[model samples]
Target chain A: MKKVLLSTLLVSLLAACAGQDVKDQPQAAVEDRAAAQTQAGADAKPTGQQSVTANPLKDPSNILSKRSVYYDLDKSDVKAEYKPMVEAHSKYLTSHKDAKVAVQGNTDERGSHEYNIALGNRRADSVKNMMNVYGVPNSQIETVSFGEEKPRATCHDESCWKENRRSDIVYQGE
Target chain B: MIFRKLLVGAAWLLLAPLAHAALTIEIVGSGANQIPISVVPFAGENALPQGITAVIAADLQRSGLFKIVDPAGVRPEPHELAEVNYPDWRTRGADALAVGSALPRSDGKLEVRFRLLDAVKQAQLDAYSYVIDRAQTRATAHKIADLIYEKLTGDVGVFSTRIAYIVKSRSHYELQVADADGYGAQTVLASKEPIISPSWSPNGAKLAYVSFERKKPIIYVQSLVSSQRQVLAQFKGNNSAPAWSPDGKQLAIVLTKDGSSQIYLINADGSGVKRLSYSSGIDTEPSFSPDGAAIIFTSDRGGSPQIYRMSVSGSGAQRLTFEGNYNVSPRFSPDGKSFTFIQRVSGSSFHVALQDLASGQMQVLTDTRMDEAPSFAPNGKMLLYATEIGGRGVLAAVSSDGRVKQRLSTQAGDVREPEWGPLLKN
Candidate 1:
């Protein structure tokens, strides 16, 4: 019985890890496709090695790649590293007319849950507004606040807090 | 020398019995009243784990303001706000009703959703959903109680908060953290010997507790998030009563490095150690004033454990509690205008008492047996403490006006030394 239980636990852990890997695949593809597009543009100017046409869906995984956007302590200002991913997502939403996504914001368990919920909503709204400005249709975006209810990491200090202060882009059903 | 001083104090106690009577008035004048309300069982497809509805109902019932109707008392089952018959509830004299439900989420967690409804109008006043781990079902119940309380009374709920307490399990004493209602309790640190004075950080992320895990009672700051811990101070003789500053920057703790248990301020990262008290007698329980300017602590320099206020920079020491012969663990309210401390009468049991700084008036908050470790809610409208109810150590809460009182108990061992953290930001 103990052996069975241990194996069951191990299998669940592995499944969770696999799910995380699957979540990372889209973003990885996005970077690869963007790099390939840049390389193709550079090659056309050089030795003229058969000018390649841009394949927008060369990496369909890029659609799912951008998973999260992080914020500073008590501040919802989007960081520079997340700008490209956000713009890419915005462009994708603009292209895919029927696609809808929900931005869920979260916080570390530092303050009152109510206050954190409000702060998380503000963060989600900020991201939604940014996407709208980037040409993503407002109808395609929905904002929700999970406050500190959902945490990627549960440590007490800044290490865990940095990870918890994030807004996740969850794709709505087709 | 300590034994001799105890003997002298005992002699004074025996000779001056009438001298202590004046202090008794501080607690006896407060009157108690019962507030009536109804908490209907939350609707759920599957019966929630660990009787969440019952726990929340009991919490409201014990608050003295609420009169929870027995489960058999309501005739027709009121599952949702729409299903609640207002005439049926109003005839039963229920001012409000709380309805809730729990659903299993895709993440293997349970999402317990609740809505508080006004019984007369049958309208939803507050609604919330709690995503809880499988192991934390009981905590979710307490959170529900906190939610309903806040909605009805317009006060911040303390149910979702955790209490750090010292418990003697088996032959060993351990420092433990449990839900404020004393459920889902687990030992944070255990020792073969003794552990005393567990203080929660202002952010509720870490705990500063005195543990004898190092053979001596030393103060250690342990993070609740990572389970990482480090000894803050292990001085020669005594290291006890670690109180976190409001800003989470400094910790006011008791250290005997100066040959006495004097108050000292150390950075939360454990540097810039400075003494705040130069008293001759043992001074302990140094709680920071809400504004962090002064500390209200227990000192025996006045021949007994009298509450004294001393500046954080170690100047302008003044006596705050003159009436009480034994007053310890003085915690300032969030507004810093009022303070709560344990007052031990000569013959009667120790009671939790609140002191108004502006008027110098005192009121007894608890009539229970041996109440101690009073901590204030972030709103300063309520206080939580540990008291012996029916010979068992349990956590309890009393409203600011002493009109509402509630007892919180757990399924496990007896809990002692309850500490409340600041109001968490959502």
Candidate 2:
């Protein structure tokens, strides 16, 4: 009876070892094959495979609909939804020291041209300042004021005016 | 000899009808249709210069209300009103006709005499002669057009007014002044760098533009007559966006010496700098209302770019625009009933829009790709703004009703940032 119990324990141990080897096989293969597959769509293929293996990071449809921060009228505080965009931009600027960007400020055609230009400049400067605080060096950012010179819409209503007053970010140099 | 005798007899017979018809037509206002006018080319005596009649004709056409009969439609008859055959002009649809001749004056100037005759009524509407220097013959023609426009439309004519704008060339930029129709432009200031934001004084005697001289942006007020410039503002951070007050006694500008952009009122002589805005975010672009009681400006304290109205003393700050997400640049119309501004929509395109001050309703003025920098005409009947066409900036004017639109293209370079000054008598 003691000899029979020892043989049963050995058989159970071999079964447990075989199950552990199966689990370890895929991970070890991934590690070993990852280097050789660098030129074979490695990043894209792995990300796709990872999506199937785990939770997806993002929904593809939401990417096109995403917008930068939109502020209240006459305000510049970042909205909660735009925090990610700002953070991403900040992160990129922080990582790339040689990258330079420009922020162009604009206004709707309601006030005097002179006034609008100054207001636009201030808006651009506001964006530049925010970027600076986000670890972007002053030299890596530039600001210009288009004022009421460039409107994105032609409507004479409040709806169009709300869209005209904005600051746009443009990557100048990489 | 027989034709001369018959013409003499006809003139005598037409005198009575001319006198009676003048009283009837001049006293009543029944004609609302096109005046059916013809401006005859002035007879050039002594071979003085080029064609001046075409200039007058073009000026009237630019108004978009005048219907000038083709030169070939009406026959060139005698210069005298009595010599014109009323039936001949009536058949040609020429309700009114202008006949003029220029002669050398004894004072070495030019005497241009013109006569306007009513073809249908067989009467003389007006007859005047101007004594001007030979070089000012074109101006004389414009004056004639002005007179005729006033006689027909019963509104003041803007043919003789000028427009000031910034022109960007390949390597240089200039502040230019030109006729209202964008002809005969002369550069008032040319710099190797950028010259921007041209503003005209109330009296139209001077222009204020921001020049990037001395490696920094400075506001320079230059007299158009004397070509003299005075650096109005050159502060530590930036001294730009100079807006002349209505009374011409002071200028409203944005200065950044106090850590944030704020509106400041300074005397035209560069004295009495009074801060008007005190806010955490930027308060810039201050444009005074027509009545000078209030100012419309752009501020970002509320989180985004939007228009705000405040008293000149910096009180009663209230938000004006709420719709959309972006609105900036607020220019008050001369009548103070409406304002014009730029609005940006999706896809990063911009257009000019007008807002009724009382109703707060807005209307888009342009449908082009990028339309901006809208300013009111002196009469508030139209708006002038900058539009990019074929990658070149051109100045465009749109009627207040948005029906009549005109593109004012400069001879060279990109013309932008137009500022229409008030009518100057001189």
TM-score of chain A of each: 0.66, 0.57
Candidate 1 lDDT over A1-174, as tens digits, reads 355346435644553553364355343322354543443332222222322664232334232344577788666667665666666667667767777877777887543222344456657767887898888876898765556645667555677788788887766541
Q: Each prediction's TM-score against the native? A: 0.61, 0.69
Q: Which stretches of candidate 1 lie over 4 Å from their true place?
A: A1-174, B1-35, B70-76, B104-112, B129-137, B347-349, B377-382, B387-398, B403-407, B410-415
| Chain B TM-score, candidates in order | 0.82, 0.87
Scored by Cα lDDT, where does model 1 land?
A: 0.66
- Score residue B258 of candidate 2 by CA lDDT: 67
Q: In model 2, where do residues sit more than 4 Å from their true spots?
A: A1-174, B1-35, B76-78
Residues B243-299 of candidate 2 have per-residue lDDT tens digits of: 888998998888877656788999998888999988887776677898888888877
DockQ of 1: 0.01
Query: On a 0 to 1 DockQ scale, where is model 2?
Result: 0.09
Please write out the lDDT profile of model 1 over residues B1-426, one tens digit for every residue.
111121111111111112111111112222243434566666663455566788888766655445675544666777655677777767877667776676677988776766666665556666656666666666566666776665555555666666777776543566778765566678776655446677878878899887544333567889988878877987654567789988899999876565446789999988888988997765778888878898988877877668889888979989989875667778899889989988876423678899999899999878775676788866676688877666566778887788777776654555676777655543
